[model samples]
Target: MNVKQEHLKETNPEHEILDILKNRWSPRAFSDKKITEKEVKILLEAGRWAPSAFNVQPWRIIWGIKGTETYDRLYNCLDEFNQSWADNAQVLMAGAFKKTKEGDKENFHALHDLGLFMANVYTQAHSMGIATHQMAGIDFKKAQKEFKIPEDFHVATGIALGYYGGDASVLPEDLQEKENKQKRERKPQSEFAFNGNFQNKN
Candidate 1:
């Protein structure tokens, strides 16, 4: 039986925030819709503008849409678990950080900067009505060798982009149950935030 996909949008925010942020939760079921090249550029441009230490902009993104050889390379670098669902995504990308910039010493904040870059990509994507899922489940060594990534760079994560699909039945029975039924969860600010100095909030 053909499992037709429905458009799905489910978000629950504990406090008032940008609608984009509220709507941006990763989905495992992605519609097989094609994403345009222009849209892909917009996402990358957003990442390019993210602030980095000393403006080094350490993050390096390599991306490809489905049906392209680049996509095959990117997809092949995913672990078996991620490959299970990531294949349905319209676009695949690898994020990496350059440990050093031209003639510069190792940047201690490179990883932190990459996180900000991805956040920018996520926000930009959500604004454009695109849903994205970032995963750390990747064969990092394979990504490096397959992509010819330099020794100075560290591959950080994988990103899958596409429209959200509603037909959870396409997934494994266990995952289908939680597809759109699960609630977004996060720890309260009190647990992480502090007044001035550390206090035993636990």
Candidate 2:
């Protein structure tokens, strides 16, 4: 299940290197295929290498394998809406960012920097034949309390990573259609980016 970066390209790649930029997305269906700890470490190592402002690495990850006690606790904390889709994941992770680094004043781009690192995690997992779907619609306050997190750390998102699951009928009707399609669709690049001037288009 080695997903070549080229195979994931939305369009042709003279536009961009498939591995560098491609159809990275979130999906609710997970194959319940447990990834080895070594592979998980490899994914995080990719995150550790992400660039940061003044080299301030503000990201922190709390993870657990499916069926573990820790995983149970973390899983229980999610809203039921997420639980239905996420319980099938082979691996679940809680993300947070240390707002203040020692000898520093400002919070540093805690959330933003964490986001960059998470991108690395996502891409690395994708290249490894793992699919990751992130959930921000989670209980941040509860995660902070349960994980015994420091006051400066802000819970960011929960992630579900594993292989793709079987069918779309497992999902709610609306989502079933999207899952069945299995194609990348977006509003339009111009709607989100501009070449210096803001010419809004969708």
Highest TM-score against the true fold, candidate: 1
Across residues 80-103, which tens digit of lDDT does each residue of candidate 2 receive? 888876777888899898888767
Write candidate 1's Cα lDDT for 27-91 as tens digits. 87777678998989999999999999999899989899999999999999999888888888899
Give lDDT for model 1.
0.83
> lDDT per prediction?
0.83, 0.77
Model 2 clash count equals: 0
Superposition error at 154 for model 1 (Å): 0.3
Taking all chains together, each candidate's TM-score versus the true structure is 0.89, 0.85
TM for candidate 2 is 0.85
Candidate 1 ranges beyond 4 A from true positions: 1-14, 102-104, 199-202
